[model samples]
Target: MKTKKVVVGALAAMLSLSVCSLAPAVAAGETVQISVGKVNAKAGETFSVDVSLADIPSTGIQCLDFAVTYDSKVLTIDKVEAGALVKNGADSKDASASLAPLFEGSVNSSEGWVSAAWSTSTDDASYWLKSDGVFCTITGKVASGVADGTVSDLKIVPINRETYSKSGVTNKEISCGYEKDGKPVKYATTLNNGSVTVGTIVTTTTQPPTNKIVRGDANCDGGVDMSDVVLIMQSLANPNKYGLDGSDSKHITAQGQANGDVDSDVKGITSNDALKIQKWLLKSISEL
Candidate 1:
């Protein structure tokens, strides 16, 4: 038992060293931003929120550690997995190299929070995440008893400071880490929080006239589904290929634009409309 304990202690110490070895160096005025995606779902339904990185530094990031807090009464975190950016970073490295980073994540259901950390096993910049994309995806299920229209906030927080401060690390702020001039460095980071909404399902028999606009029917396909969401996103992201006036035959039509304008306040068909259609499809909302 004593031998086993010693081995365990050694492993823990190694992990701590790996994470803290990348010290936080003062960055110029450049700042990186972390954002959580917004989502909507019905009670008892499973949903995913993406934590993305934007404004990634040219030097890239070798390590990341942060915590996210949510409303436990409304949802329970299932798991957090590596996102596309992390996977791409691994794929860019040598094929024989281990694909997995030194990662650790845990959830405190009672406290409604999750903490996660990831780092390359070595100081190699080739293994660092260099792109702006999803860093992780958090999957959760809405509480069965959650009321319709209920909204839960998801915010980034510093990792367990008291626990990490014991390592003699001067910085416990949530941010990405890299090495500069052989010293560990960190970037100025901005946190953009997100929210999840629980919407009520209402069934209706009324139908709009054939000539009238149908909300969320972006493709004019009589009904809304994942396709409409895709079309809207495509049209917005690449207007020349999918825009209303694009050369493509499948370009969005004027009628499609009118129908896809689910958010009247937004003035035009935007990603918000696509999101509303997605929620409607999930039965989270009664209408677009």
Candidate 2:
């Protein structure tokens, strides 16, 4: 970890001018993507999202600067930390490379936005990030008054000069890529945003009837079987057709969602729930 002032100074110097036009087009057949992870939490609960990178170029990446925005009314950013990709520093193609990356960020809870910059601490190319993994983590707290079922988007956007003026500005676009012979080369990139959904909180005073829930019986046909797995997958892949409020008569209901949430590692009815059901049916696992 680098000092915030030092990191901000380096970022400011690097982004003082726009470099968007100087970047070359992405190579054919090469793909680069940045994504934000999603999760479910209750109002006033603390949560975190992972910012990940995929399909790093053969040359590897040296520096990255990006911003994430959220609905301030529903969430407040707490902290930003370096992730595995920066700390572990393993190159996919080079077994010997061990990078020492530095990370720093600034958060504005009132604006519901946070900006971060990460890079190799030295000019050595060996220190660059060369693998696909999490780049950073953003921790936040959901507003206490938010209602259940409310969803807040965690959107990735360009680092705006005006917003991150203290950190300086290179361009309004997301800056990523490595230096080629001392010159920065940007990558052609794609982005996938994520969200945090407020879930129903079970309290002693009043809660959904747990006794009525038939765990793993997602289809509500009175049995835990492969059909329940199918329903869970369908609901996730085609929510409008098989979701809780789906128009299709075979849509999974609220009870189905509760029943399908057998996997403790994840919240809500995800594909993991479907996999758990399959495992139980195969006798690989005694129960869901």
Best by lDDT: 2
- TM-score, cand. 1: 0.60
What are the lDDT scores of the predictions, listed in order?
0.66, 0.68
Q: Which residues of candidate 2, in runs, are more than 4 Å off?
A: 1-29, 89-101, 162-170, 200-288
Per-residue lDDT tens digits for candidate 1, residues 237-286, read: 44545666656777777777778879753445555677788888999988
Off by over 4 Å in 1: 1-24, 89-100, 162-171, 200-288
Residue 95 Cα positional deviation in candidate 1, in Å, after optimal superposition: 13
Which RMSD values do the candidates have, in order? 10.3, 8.4
Local distance difference test, candidate 1: 0.66
